[model samples]
Target chain A: MKIAVLGSGNGGCAVAADFALKGHDVYLFDFEEFNENINAIMKNGGIFVDGDFVGFAEIKYAGHDIEKVITGADLIMVVRPAFGTKLFAEAAKGYIQKGQKIVICPGSCGGSLIFKKGLGLELEDESIIVSETSTLPYACRVIAAGKVHIYIKLLGGIYLAAIPSRLTENVLIDLKEVYPGIVPAKNVLQTTLQNGNPVIHPAVTLLNAALVEREKGDFYFYEEGVTPSVGRLMEAVDKERIEIGKKLEIEIIPNPVLGLIQGYMQESNYDTGYSKGRGFKGIKAQSKLDNRYMNEDVGYGLVFMSELGKQIEVETPIMDSIINIASVIMGKEYREMKSRTPETLGLSSYTVDELINVL
Target chain B: MKIAVLGSGNGGCAVAADFALKGHDVYLFDFEEFNENINAIMKNGGIFVDGDFVGFAEIKYAGHDIEKVITGADLIMVVRPAFGTKLFAEAAKGYIQKGQKIVICPGSCGGSLIFKKGLGLELEDESIIVSETSTLPYACRVIAAGKVHIYIKLLGGIYLAAIPSRLTENVLIDLKEVYPGIVPAKNVLQTTLQNGNPVIHPAVTLLNAALVEREKGDFYFYEEGVTPSVGRLMEAVDKERIEIGKKLEIEIIPNPVLGLIQGYMQESNYDTGYSKGRGFKGIKAQSKLDNRYMNEDVGYGLVFMSELGKQIEVETPIMDSIINIASVIMGKEYREMKSRTPETLGLSSYTVDELINVL
Candidate 1:
């Protein structure tokens, strides 16, 4: 199958290389501002894959032209941070063809909804299918410009759902070719709530804001940062998220349980599960508070959950609290920013039943 | 002058010794559960003073008997943590005589009001003058039972106020003898708003919750635990506190400016003012999340400010956020606990003007 990957960062490079290595035609593209990795990949002719999937896979195309990348693609994957979703979607709007599929790998809370709106399409438009995954399929990184490292390929426990409930299976069938563990979710809400980065990242980062700035995040984030108090905070956020899911009639798995299933943890408890988790053994925290942990997770992810809770009448005091503190730490009012709130997703007046029916 | 110092902890011992050294008859009292320090003082017949003030000071009495401690005392200084204000007030209720002045050394947000309520006295009842100070005059600690170390006796910038406002001068006159830097406040609200612990303690502690747990608070709290982001959080809380004070027609000095005026900081910026503050130089953080930094500061201080903001129609989102997160970290609902709030202090129904009139 011909595939178009619309980001050349860590996840984008890994996704592009993984499919290219599987003998599929892969075209990688990024914004011109991020041409460092694109230029390197063009010169090298492909991305270097290491660890779980080791090889140098050749790409059909790598450049700044979105038209060349997505015109004849069988599948399009938008792999960018949550904040970049709208930018990428807007960039691809004029070129998006009918019946084409675009999946945001690891939709950080309602990424599909945001992407659909950014593409100037109604959420219920059936001419094109837009979907999102619960999480990225690989714990990977771009070691250098065109060199990528795949720590793990995420053997199981990834959920995918289209914007419209009826079309989730169609997207899952296409995604399963690359991710055998990809499962169809009830709707995009399930995929959004099931993504636990919002539940864990902001809580851990806000609680460790000073430590990260002081030590320049020299300490292992999961091992030393996930103390009992920090775990309790994550639990508080996770409880609010699960409550929001219950209000929406979506059964969301707790973060620790999901961590265990995803092979990220050996235990199913918040504290020791992450602290002693085999997968998170050596991940260091970001050296500053302005990183994606608080900005993307709190601004986009938690703000989305908190607004959804407000619409559905499920109290999310903990999520709101984390958003408030994170906003202060980042010197921005995240709640007021409306980066990915219900209103921003064009669901401000959405009734619980209406939301359930639509999504 | 005859002085009774309630709570034989650090502040209590320091106050008792300071007055005794000035030739006033000092009597120290505490609950029997904390008879260790009381018993030590009883055995030694005095408290050993060190640091800024170095000398042996005689105490008129030291025991757990409240009647003996309060009877015939011209002035009573309640120097316990904010949580103990009510307990100590209830203990001194039966022995509190007319015309005697009782002052909570640092009214951790409406301490005088809680103390008066705990004494079963109507706020307007002026039989005994109930007063409070903006903060403790000395940054001192009890090195051991019957031994106290005075790090620095503050030379200026302490505000004192009485319940009726008119009688503030009377308490100020007596307190000024020991706390020469003390000045009169507009009301108890001024004293409450001027206290900076709620602005600094919980913000810094919550931001460093995991580090405190992992390191057992081995680092210098102010110098190391405080960073740019932590200072920003503190500044946010301080802004909310000042807004609450403004709604009540009380002019509150910003925390960093107050810290400079009180000699706790050489610089007047929140970030480095705390990180490099000469007065805060070697103070260590609490070894656990369950310490008074959160309990006394958040439960009593931030909660009171938040509740006051609610009653006065002033927004305190940051204060409320810190209270919510601290409640989760401590596993207690601080807002619902009513440990200290406008309702608990009998100011819940007051309008802004009425609240200003009362305080």
Candidate 2:
């Protein structure tokens, strides 16, 4: 199997290394401005992996050229934050060949829809398969140049869904080799609703905003930041997500069970689970309020979810609140921009059933 | 001159003591459950003042009996949180006599309007004059029963407005004796729009949620909690407020200037004022998120402001966001209850101009 990773950030590096270690030819690509990691990988001729996944894995290609990276690749994975999807989509649209699969790892929120729109591809187009997962498979980071640390490789929580819905199985066949635990979703909407990042990141970051600003990333994000009151806010957001999922007829896992499966906590409810959860004990808070937690998760993820609620006529007051707060803190007009919305995706005219069938 | 001060908490005690010190016959009143302070004052034959104003000022009457408290009072002051306005109104309804003036100290947001609704009285009634001030005259707290520590007595900040705009001057003349700095506003809407507590408390409390939970009221709230990011959120809410005021043709002071006038901060902008302000240095953060900051400010103050924006067809995203977050944290459905809204005040049927004229 040949794979191309269209980002050189921590998620991109981890995904590329895992595939290479599994005996697949992996090509890592990034824009020149973010080419430092790929440049180090090129210099070392491989990626250094530590923690859960150990040893070095050789990559066949590492560069800024998108065409060279994806040449003859069987699968291409976009592993950047949701905000970076449009850029990758623009970069890949001209180079992508027929039958090549593009899977967005942790679409964060509505990644596949936004990416497909960026490519100007129709849902019925069968030349290429586009799919998205609920979240990234590994909680990993780049420790240093050419070196990555794998905290926990997700086991049973990740879900994948393809554009046009029917193509989900085709994308899953090849992806299963790299991510054996990955399962097919009913549709992209199902995958998006299962995205717990939108439920967790923004609320936790916002509720702990002062601490984050004061300590400058010195506090344990989950252990010290998420108090009982903070956890309830996240739960309220999760309830809205669950209601939206129900309205769409998707069998969405409630956030606590999903959190447990995704390695966030030992318990199955918000109050006890978030406060006592050891899975997220030592993670440092973001030093700034404008990080990916608010930018991607709230701006992209919650904005899309809240808009979907609007389309389905399901009230999402909590989700809307998170987006509004994120906009103020980040100094962005998210509501006015109608960001990642059904209207932006050109799906505003479709009924919920139509949207599901189209996906 | 006899003055009736309802709801004997810290503010009530302080205001009652201030009037008594000025040689007015003060009748301090509260429910029996909260009579501890008044009972101690009665035992001491007056209130024990400390800090700026020191001495025991005699009170003619101090009890939970509403009828006895207002029997011969020249003025009535409601000094409780905005949430308590209804209880006070209900208690004083039949007991209230024509020509007897009632004023809400720190009306917070729409205090006069909500109180009017609770009394089932129209602005045109003219039987009684109802007015409100932007904030309390002094920043004081009860060190113990009958003992209040006065921090600062506002010099030239408070603004008062009556329900019927024409009645403002008459209400202010008597109020000016006790509150020497009191100035007549254009209307109650102007006073409500000038409210700075609603603009400050909820946003700062929410942004510093974790710190408040962990520190448990140990931190100096304004100096430590109002980071640049948190200040920006309040500014965003303030922008919505200013825009709403403009739509209604009210001369609303921006929150920073209003904060300086009300003595919350020294500077006139959020970034510099909140960080460098000497006025807010020693105020402690609430020990829990369920305090009056969220309950009163967000529930009554921001809720009314946002609903006013809705009625005027102006956008109040930040205000709405704060209310939504507060609802989730406090486990209440604020929007559904239409908490302290224009409709609740029976002004929903009126046009913006009509509502303005009625005020």
Candidate 3:
């Protein structure tokens, strides 16, 4: 399989290395501003993976040229945060090949929609298969310049769905070879709603905003930051997400159960699961509240969900609240800025059934 | 002057004692559930004032009888939080005399409106004068039963406004004798808009939520919790508040300036002022995120401002965000459960000018 991974952040590096080690021709590309990781990998001639997936993977191509990375690529993974979604899509506009599969790893709320819009492609365009996963498959981080630490390779329950609702199966069939845990979701709506990033990250990060700013990532975020009361807030937000799913007639996994499946928790309850769970044992809080945990999850993910809730007539007070708090903390208007919604996806005029059919 | 002080919380105790020492016939009342302070005062036959105001102040009356407190009282002050605005109004309804002046010290965002609704009185009702102050004058706390440690008495900049635009002068004249810092505002809109509590408390408390929950109020709130980034958020919310005031043609002192006026902060900028302010020194953060900072301030204060902004077609994104975040953390629909707005105040149908007139 020929794969092009966009962005060389922690997730991007992990994906590129894992694929390259599996003997797939992997091309990793990042913008000039984000070329540090890829430049390090290029200099090192390979990426060293530790923890669950331990190996050195030699990437076939590593550069800033979007055309060089996308040309003739069988699968293109948009692995950047929501902040970079549009930029990557814009870069991939003229270069995206026909019949190529595009996957937004950990879509970070409406990634597919944002990408589709950015690509200037119609929502119903079927020339290229576009899919998004609920979250990234590997709970990994960059330990060094060129070395990535793969914490937990999710054994099961990584959800994948395609825009226009038809291309999910084919995309899943190919990607499942690398991520056996990946499963086909009903639609992009399912994949979007199933995203627990917006549910957990922003709330947890904002709840511990001052501490994160104070400690500079000194403590385990999940273990120390998420107390009983904070746990209750996470549950309330999770309930709102589930309620939105019910309204949309989409089957979504609850947060705790999903956390267990995603290898983020041992318990199927918020407090015990997040605080004591081995899956999140070594995960440190973001050094600042302005990181992707907020910018991506709250700014894009929660904003998208809130917009979706407005479209579906389901009140997402908790999601709105998180987006609101994140926007203030980040000094940006998230809802007014980039957000994935029915309107943005060109499904604003569609009824719930019609919208479901289209997605 | 015969004054009846309602609610036995920190502010209420301070008000009761201050007025009593100033030779006013002060009647302090609390519900049975909150009668502990008054009971202690009754037992002590006075309130022990320590800090800025130092001495024992004899109370003419101290009990749970609302009638005993309201009867023959020239002035009635509701110093409870916004949470008790309605209950206090209900308690003071029939007992309130025709010529008596009622003041909600530090109205906590639309307290005058909420009080009017609870009292079932028209905004135009001039037989009795109703007024609200931008904030409580003294930043004090009760060290023990019937004992309060006064921090700083505000020298100036406590805004006072009446329900109708007409009654502000008389209310200000009387309140000035007790709270010399009290100055006449344009209307209740000025008083409500001038409130910096909703701006500072909810953001700071929510930002430092996990730390507060974990440490149980061990650290000084402003000095430790209001980091540079968190201070930026406070400034952003303050901007939205200032915008609301502009839209309504009401003059609002910026949060930092208001803080200086209310004696909570000395510096004019958020970071330098809050982190280093003598007024905010030694103030402890709430032990939990569910306290009045989130509950009263975000739930009522921000909600009211957002609603007003919506009515006037002014955007209050930051205020809306704070309210939303606070609501989720507190596990309640603050906008629905408790909020002071045009509709809640029965002024929903009024135009901007009419609303201004009524307020």
Model 1 alpha-carbon miss at residue A296, Å: 1.2
lDDT of model 3 at residue B9? 90
TM accuracy, model 2: 0.90
Tens-digit per-residue lDDT, B1-359, candidate 1: 98999989998999999999999999989999999888988998999999878999999899988999999999999998888888898888888989899999888878898888888889889999999999988888787878988877777789999998999998888877778888999998899889988898998998899989998988878999899988999999888888887887889999888878788888999899998887787788887878989988898888888878877788988898898889888899988888887788887888888987877
Pairs that collide, model 1: none
Q: Rank the candidates by lDDT, best first.
A: 1, 2, 3
In candidate 1, the second chain superimposes onto the true chain B with a TM-score of: 0.97
Q: Choose 1 or 3, whichever is better by DockQ.
A: 1
DockQ each: 0.82, 0.69, 0.51
For candidate 1, give the docking quality class from DockQ. high
Cα lDDT, model 2, residue A111: 82
Model 3 lDDT on a 0 to 1 scale: 0.83
Compose the digit string of candidate 1's lDDT tens values, residues A1-359.
99999999989999999999989999999999999889999999998889877999999899999999999788999999998999999899899899899899978878898899899999879889999999998888788999998877886789999989799888888877789988888898899889999988888887888989988889888999999988999999999999999988999999999887888888999999999987787778887778888888888889899988988899998888888888888889988888888888788898989888988
Error of 3 at A245 (Å): 5.2
* Candidates, ranked, TM-score: 1, 2, 3
Per-residue alpha-carbon lDDT of candidate 3 for residues A190-223, written as tens digits (9 for 90 to 100): 8888988888888788888888888898888898
lDDT of 3 by residue, B1-359 (tens): 98899988999989999888889999999989987788899999889999877999999888999999999888889998887988999988889879888899888877887887688888778888888998898888998998998887777888888878678887778777778777889888888889888888877887888888888988889888988768888888888888888877887789888777667676788887998887777888886666888877877788888888888888987777676666666768888874677677676787887766656
What tens digits encode model 2's per-residue C-alpha lDDT throughout A229-285? Answer: 788898899889999999988988987897687776689987668767756655788
Best by TM-score: 1
